[model samples]
Target chain A: MAEEKIRVLIAKPGLDGHDRGAKVVARALRDAGMEVIYTGLRQTPEMIAEAALQEDVDVVGLSILSGAHMALLPKTVQLLREKGLDHVLVVAGGIIPDEDVPKLKEAGIAEVFGPGTSTQTIVEYIRNKVAEIRRSRKNA
Target chain B: MFDKEALEKIKERQEQWEETTLQQWLARLPERDELFRNLSDMPIARLYTPADIPDFDYLEELGFPGEYPFTRGIHATMYRGRLWTMRMFSGYGSAEETNERFKYLLKHGETGLSVAFDTPTLYGYDTDDPMAEGEFGKCGVAVSSLADMEILFDGIPLDKVTTSMTINAPAAILWAMYLVVAEKRGIPWTKIGGTIQNDILKEYIAQKEFVFPPKPSMRLIVDTFEFGAKYVPKWNTISISGYHIREAGATAVQELAFTLYDGFEYVKAGIERGLDVDEFAPRLSFFFNAHNDFFEEIAKFRAARRIWAREMRNRFGAKDPRSWWLRFHTQTAGCTLTAQQPENNIVRVAIQALAAVLGGTQSLHTNSMDEALALPSELAVRIALRTQQIIAHETGVVNTIDPLGGSYYVEYLTRKMEEAAYEYFRKIDAMGGMIAAIEKGFPQKEIADAAYRYQKEIDEKKRIIVGVNEYVSDEPITIPIHKIDPEGERRHRERLARVRRERDNERVRQCLERLRNAAQDERENLMPYILDCVRAYATLGEMMKVLREVFGEYREPIII
Candidate 1:
C-alpha cells in the first residue's frame, strides 16, 4: 500500500501532568501504524495548536486531568480553528465528565473518549475521522 | 501457633488433600482464568494456608499494636478509642471560595483539612503570573501570598484544626505563609499542628512538580526538618509520600518500597545535615495511597510499618519509640475512580477507604465520586467524607486493632510484600540509593512499566475495572461536578495585584534578597528567610523567582 501512515499528535494541553492515558493511547496509535508526536505535560493551547500545525498531523489528541478541560479544551479547539487547522480531527481523552462531552463536541472536538474507553475504539474513531477528512479534501 | 510435629503432619495432610480434594474439584470445574494474579501480575494462590507462611512469627514480625516492628498498628487502641481523621482534601478556585469549602467540610464533620493547592501554587507561581495564565485555581485552591492564606483559612481557627497542605517544590514558602497566617491569628508556630507535603524526591520520581535541583531541594527539605524540630515541634515537616507514586501507576510493592526508600533518604539527609535522627524522625510522617486491591493494599500497609520500624530503629539507630513509628495518612486512590458511571466510584472509594482503615491509617481521605471529572462538588465531598465516617462508625472492622492481622492470606501477602520491597531496596542500594536510582530513571521506568502492563491488562480484558473495562457503562453522568469559574482567574489576578500594590515593597525586596542569600548558602536554614519573606507579605512567585535566580530551576531529564 502506497498510503502514508495517518499522522496523529497526542498532546497534554494542561498542567495536570497525567500522561499515562496519553502515553498508552500514543503507544496504541503507534502500534496501529500511525505516526504520532507527543507534546509533553504542561502545554498551553498555543503550544498545542502551534505544534499541531507545524507537525501537519491529521489528528490532535488532548489529554487533560486537571479538571481544566472546560477552560482548556475549548480554547485549544478554537486556537486550532484560528490556525486554519479545523480539519485536524480533534479528539480528547481523560477524566472528562459526561455533561462536558457535549460541550466539548460543541467546541469543535470531534470525539470525547472518557475513562474505560479501549484504544481500539479510539483507534477506529480516529481512522474513521481521518478517512472522512481525506475524502472531503479529495472531493473539494 | 502449631507445634513443629503438628505443622509437619498438617503440611503432609494438606499436600494429600490438595492432590485429592482440590484435584477432584478442579477436574469437575474449570477455573475462571489460566492464572490468578494481583495487579502487579504477582501469582496469587487460590487459597493460602499455614504452608504459605510456615515460619510466621507473630511476636517477631507483627508485634502487638504500638510495639516494635508495628506490623499490627502504631496506636494501641486503634479505632476503638478514636477513628482516623476524615481529612478530606479540598480546594478549588480562589482563596475565598476554598475558605467556604473548608467551612462546609468542617460543618459536615470533617476532622482535618487537606489543602489542595492549584497547579500555579504547586509550581511556585502567583495567579497573576504569565506562566499561570489559564491555570489559576484549576487544580486546587490558588493562594499566592500570606493574604490569600489568611483568607483561605478565615474563621478556621489555626490551633483548633490540623491542615495538610499538599504543596511541593515551593513547600517552604507556602508553609511559611501558613505559619505567618497562624501568627497573625495570634497562634504560635508551636501551637500549629498540620503537615506540609515537602516530599520533593517523589516529585522528581512521580509527580513532576519539582522546581529546584535535587541538591537544593533536599537542602530546603532539611531546613524544614531542622526548623520543625526546633520551632514548630508538633508539625509533621515532611509527609514522605507514595500516594503519587501509586497514582502514577506503581504496583503496591513498588509504592511500599519506593516510599520507604524516600523516607530513608530523608533520614540520611537529616543526619548528613548534622541533625539528630530522633529529633526530626518522630515528626516525619508518611502518606500512602489505598488503591483497589483490598488485601494487597492491606498487606502493603502492614509491610510499610514493619520496614519503617526496623529501618528507623536498627539502621538509623533512632532510640525514641516515637521515631520508630510509621504514622501515615492514607487517601483512597483517585486514579481508580472512573468518569464513566460516576456513582460507581462511591462504592470503590468505600472499599479502598475500608482497606486503608483496616491497614491502620492514622488519617484517611476518601476520593469523591466526581473527582475524575472535576475537583468535587459539595454533595460529592460529603459522600466521600460519609464513606469514611460509615467505615469508622458503621463498619465493625475497626472495633478491634489489626482485625485482619491473623488471616493466613493477609500474613502471607504481607510477608511477600516485605520481601519484594527488600529486593527493590537492594536494587536501589546497588544503584547508589534512591536519588541516583531516580537520576537513572529507576522508579520512573518501574512505574511506567507497571502502568503499561496495567493498561494492557485492561485493554486485553485480563484485569477488570468494574465500570471501566468489565461492567461497561454508557450511562450519562448526571452527578454535578464542581467547575471553577472562568472568572476566577481574573478575580484572583486582581487580588494578587492588590496584594502586590498594598504590601510594603521595600520589605518584600529585602526579605527576598535575604532568602536568595540563604538559598545560596549551604549552611543557612532557608526556612527563617522564607518566613521573613512570608511576613513581609511577599508573593510565592516573587520569592520562588529569587530562589530560582539563586539556585536555578530544575529541568527534568526526559525519559523515553
Candidate 2:
C-alpha cells in the first residue's frame, strides 16, 4: 500500500491581521511534504473546526496572536470533541506565554509551540505523533 | 600595546580552544561542507569601525539640525522646542465607542490623535454590506458613512489637534469623510491638518489590506496628493510607512530599503501627475517601526533621513529644503510583544520608545503591554501614553539633539545601511519600479526569506527574546484583558439603517453618479466628487463599490 499522507490545516483565529508568521509556518509544512491548507486571517473557531472537519485533516494547527487563545482554543477543542474528532491532534503556535502552555495542554491540546520554535521541530513532532497514534490504533 | 607575556597567554588560550573546535573534528572525520553565509543572513562584522565611514564629511553627511541631508535632526531645536507628539493609535467597536476612546486618550495627556479603522472601513464597506458581516467593529472603529465619521470625531475640534488615520485602499474616500466632517464644524479645507496612511505599495508588501489593483490604487493616491497640495496645504497626504513591513517579519535593513523604495515610487507618481516635487513633497511624511534592535533602529532612521534628502535633491532635483527633509512618526513594534509574562512588554516598549526619540522621530505611538493578548485596555493604553510622556519629561535624552550621532557603531551602521538600501533601490529600479517589483513578487520573496532566516536564528538560540524562549515564567495572565462589545455589529447596522432611511436618496444617487463619472476620467480628480458624495451621506460601501467595478480587486501573488 502507498504511504498515507499527513494532512494539516493551518488556520488564523480572531481579528489579528498579522499573518507573516502564519504564512511562513504554512509554507514550511508544505515544503516538508505535508498537504497543508491555510485558511486566511480573521477566522472564527467555528469556521476553523468546520473547515478541519470538511478537509478531514490528521492535524489541526491554530495560530492566534491576539491573546484570545485561552478563550478561543478551548471552544475549538470542545467543538472538535463534540463532532467526534478527538483522535485528530490539535496543535497551536503564536506569541503564547510559557505559563499558559500547561493550561492549554490540560485543555486537550496535543502540543503548544511558542514563537521562535523551529519549523523542523514542528514537522518532526507532528510526524512522530501521527506515527505513534497509528501504531497504537493498529495494536488495538 | 599588549604585553608579550599577556599576548602569548591569549594565543595559547585561543590555540587550546581551536584544538577542540569543530574544524578539528571535521578534519578527523570528513563531512560535507555547508554554505557558511546566506543571501539573507545579517553579518555580525557589517557592524562597526571608522573604516566603513571613512569619507564621512560631518557637515555634509550629518549636517546641523534643520539643514540639507537632515540626518542629525529635522529641526534646529527639535524636542527642545517641543517634545515629539505622543499620539497613541486608538479605536475599537462602533463610531460612538471609538469617539469616547479618542476623547479619553486626549484627556490623558496625548498630544495628538491617531485613528484605527475597522476591517470593513479599511476595505471600504458599509456596516450593512454582506461582505462586512461579523467584521464591523472587530478590529477597529467602523466608519461606514459621514455620520459614522462625524460620530468618531464628535466633540473634538478638527483645527485644534492633528489626527492621523491608519487607513489605506479606501484612503481617499475616508479622507473625504474627514473633510466633510470638518466642513460641517465650520473648519476650512486649508485650516485642517492631519495625515493619511495612503501608502499602497506597502499594502501589497505587508499589511494585505489593499482593495484595488496597484495601478488604480496609485491613481487614487496621486489624486490625494494633488487635492491636498491645492487645498489642505498643511495636511500630510501620505505617511510613507515601514511599520507594517517590519511587523510582517522583515529585518531592519529590508524594512528601511523597501519602505524608501515605496516612497520613491510615490514621488514618481506625484511628478507624473504634474505636481512639482517641492509642492507636494513637503507634505509627505513617514512612519516606521521601532523594533528591539535599539542601535540598529536608531541607525535606520538616521540613514533614512540622509538618503531621502540626497535622493530628493540630487535625483528628484528639488530646490526647497522642506522637500529634502524626511519627517516621520514612530510606533513600537507590535510583533515584539509576548503573551507569556505580558507585563514584561512594558519595559520592551519603553526601550523601543527611547530609541525612536533618539532617532529623532517627529511623533510617536508606544504599543501597550497587553497588545499581544487583545486590543489594549483603557488602563494599558493610558500606561503606553504615559511611557512616552516619561521619556520626554524625565529622560534627559531629549535635552540634546542627535545624542548618539558620533558613536562609532552608530555611524558605521548608518553608512552601511545607506549603502545596502541604495543597492536594493538599484535592483528595484532594474526591475522597473516598486509596482513592477511587487507584481513580479521580488520584495515579497525577499521579506519572506528574511523572516524565515530570522526565525531560524531565534530557534537556534542565536537570538534571545526575553519572556519567550529564554527566562520563561509559569504564571497565569493576571492582567485584565479588553473585551469587544457583543452589540457593536448590531448597533452599527442599526445606525446604518437609520442613515439610509433619513438621508436624501436622490442627492446620494447624483453624488455617486458624479463620482463614477470622475473615476472613469483620468483628467478629473476624484476628491471633489468624493467630498460631494460624503456630503450626501453616501455610504463608504457605495462609493468603493463603484470604484471596485471600475478598478477590479488586487489579488496578491503567492511566491513563497
Candidate 3:
C-alpha cells in the first residue's frame, strides 16, 4: 500500500501584498510530495482557520510580512483550536524578528522560519513533525 | 564598430589566446566553475571581443547623448549637470510621526520626498475600519483622510520639492488628497511637481494590490493622464514600474520586458481615450529595480531607453522629443538583502546604487541595511543616504556621460537585453496585450517559477549568498531596529474619528454621490469628481467604497 500524503495549507494573513515568499514556499512543499493548498492574499484568521478545517490539513503554514503576526498568527491558532483541530501543527514565516520567534512558539506555533531558510529545512520539519503526531495519535 | 579586416584579426587573436594562454591557465587553476551565470541566471562568456557585437553602429545604434535612440543617455550633460535625486521611500506610524521622518530625510540632503503609505492606506481603508485590524501604520504612514494628509505635509514646502507617493490601487484618491493639500496652501497644481505611482496593471501582474478589475482600472488611469495633462503639466501621471515585478522574483529580462510592455499598454489606452500620443505620453515616467548583477542592471536600463525611444517615435508616431524620453527612478533591490550578517547589505546596496547611477537614473533610493528585519532605523536610513552622496560627490563617475558606453561586453549585453524584451513583447502581443496575459495567469506563473527556481538554487548551494549559505553567522543581532511607537496607532485612530465627527457629513455625501454617478459614465473624467470628494474631506475608504460599489473588486486567479 502507498503511504498517506501529508496535507498542508499555506495562507497569507494580512493586507501587505508581498507574496513571493508564500508562493515559493507553497510550490516547494508541493514539489516535496505533499498535498499543498495555498490560500491567496488578504486572508483573515477566521478565513484561514475555516479553510484549515475544511481541507483537513495536518499542518498550517502562515506567511505574514506586514508585522502583524503578533496579532494575526496567534488568533489563527486560537481559531484552529476552537474548531477542535488541536493536533494540527502551525508554523509561521516571513520577516519575523528573532525575539518574536520564542513568543510565537509559546503561542502555539510549532516553529518560526525567518528569511533565507532553505525549503529543505521546512520540508523535513513538516515530515518529521507530522509523522510524530501520527504515532502519538495511534498510541492515544 | 570595427572594420571587417580588423574584426577578423581580433577574433583570430582571441581564439589563439583562448587556446594557448587561456588553456595554460585553465590547466593550473581549472576555473571556479564549469559555468558562470549572473543573478538572472544568464550565462556569461569567459571573454567578450569585437566579434560579439559585430553589427554595432556608432550613430544608428548608439546615438549621441540627448539624441535619437538615446542608448547613451537622455540628457547631454547627464550627472555632470545635476545629480540624480536622492529620494528615500519612508513612512511609518501616524501622520505626525511620518511627517517628522520626512523632515529628517529632507534635512539630511534628500532631494525629493517619497511617501510610503501603510498597508491599510494602500488598500484604501480608513484607520478605524475593521478590515484594517492590526495593519495600521505597519508598512507605512496611515493616511485615511485629507486631514491626515494635511498633517503629513504640514511644514513641508509643496512648491520647492517634488514628492513621489508609492501608492496604488487607491492611488487616485491619495493623489486627490495631495492636490487638495496643495490647493489649500495656495499653490497652483502646475507649480506642484511630483509623480503618482498610478500604474495599476502591475498591481495585477506582480504587486497584487489591485482593488477593481482591469477595465475600470485602465479607465481611472486614463482619466488621470487626461486631467494631469491639462492642469498639472509637471506631474507624471503614471510611473510604469518593474520594481515589484523584480521583487517578485522575475529575471532582469522579464523585468525589462514586462515594464516596457506595460508602458506600451498605457500609451494605447490614452490614445484610445481620444488623446494624442504626445499630449499624455510625455508625462509618463518609469520606475525600475537595480539588482545585484551590476552589468546586467546597467544593460537593462540602457536597453530600456533605446527601446522606448524607438517605439515611441516609430510605432506610436510621437512627434515631441519629450515623448520619446524614458525618464526613470530606481530603487535598489530589496529581495537581495539578507537577514543574516545584515551589515553585508550595506555593501550590496552600494554596488546596486552605483549601478543605478551608471545606468543614468533620474532619481534613486538605496535600501537600508536593516530592512531585512524591519523598517529602517534612523541610523540605517542615514547610512543609505550617505551611500548615494558618496557615489555622487566623491566618485568621478559623474564627470563623464555613459562612461561604459563603448565596452564590448556592456554593448553586447544591451543589445541582447533589447532582443529578449522584443521577444516577450511579441508573445504578449499575440496574447492580446498585458491585461489579457495577466488574466490568463501567464506572467504570474512565469514569476512564480523563477522564484521557486531561485530558492532551489540557493538551497542546493549552486548560489552562495554570503552569511546565508556560505559564511554562516551565529551571533545575535545587536543593531537597533526601528520600532513603531505603540501609542501612534491609538492617536491616529482618535484623530480619524475626530475628522469624521467634525467634517460636514452632508457635503461628503453629496461629493460621493456625484462621484458614483460620474463613475457610471465611460466618457466622464473621474479625477475632477475625485478632487471634489477630496475637497469635501471624504475618507479614502469612503471614496473607494463608492468605486467598489460601481466597478466591483477584482479577484485574481490562483497560480502556484
Q: Judged by TM-score, which candidate is best?
A: 3
lDDT of 3 by residue, B1-560 (tens): 68999999999999899999999999999988999988667789988888999888999988899998888899989998889999999999999999999999999999999999998899899988888888888889999999999999999999999999998888889999999999999999999999999899889989989999999999999999999999999999999999999999999999999999999999999999999999999899999999989999999999999999999999999999999999999999999999998999999999999999999999999999999999999999999999999999998899999999999999989998999899999999999999999999999998898999899999999988999999998998888989999999989888888888999999999999999999999989999999999998889999999999999999999898
User: Model 2: per-residue lDDT, tens digit, B1-560?
Assistant: 33556656765765676568756876897654343322234444523444445555688778799897899999999999999999999888988888889999999999899999887788887877655555557568989888889888999989989999999999998999999899889999888899999998998998878889998999999999999999999899999999999888788888899999999988988999898999999999999999987888898999999999999998899899999989999999998887778899999999999999999999999999988766889989989999999998898998999999987688877887888898999999999998999999898888888877777667666667787778987888888887777787688888889999999999999999889888999888999999999899999999999999988988778655
Could you tell which candidate, 1 or 3, scores higher by TM-score?
3
Could you give candidate 3's per-residue lDDT for residues A23-135 as a string of tens digits?
A: 99999999999999999999999999999999999999999899888989999999999999999999999988888898899989999989999999999999999999989
The regions of model 3 sitting more than 4 angstroms off are none
Model 2 Cα interface RMS deviation (Å):
4.2
Which residue pairs clash within candidate 3? none
Error of 3 at B57 (Å): 0.6
In Å, residue A73's CA in model 3 sits off its true spot by 0.7
**Mind sharing the TM-score for model 1?**
0.96
- Please rank every candidate by DockQ, starting with the best: 3, 1, 2
Residues A1-140 of candidate 1: C-alpha lDDT, one tens digit per residue: 77778999999876777777887788788889999898877889999999999999999999887777887899998999999996899999887767779988999988988777888899999988798899999899
Which residue pairs clash within candidate 1? none
In candidate 1, what are the lDDT values of residues B504-526, reduced to their tens digit?
99998888888888877799999
RMSD in angstroms, candidate 3? 0.8
Q: Where does model 2 sit among the CAPRI classes?
A: acceptable
- Model 2: colliding residue pairs: A66-B373, A67-B373, A97-B340
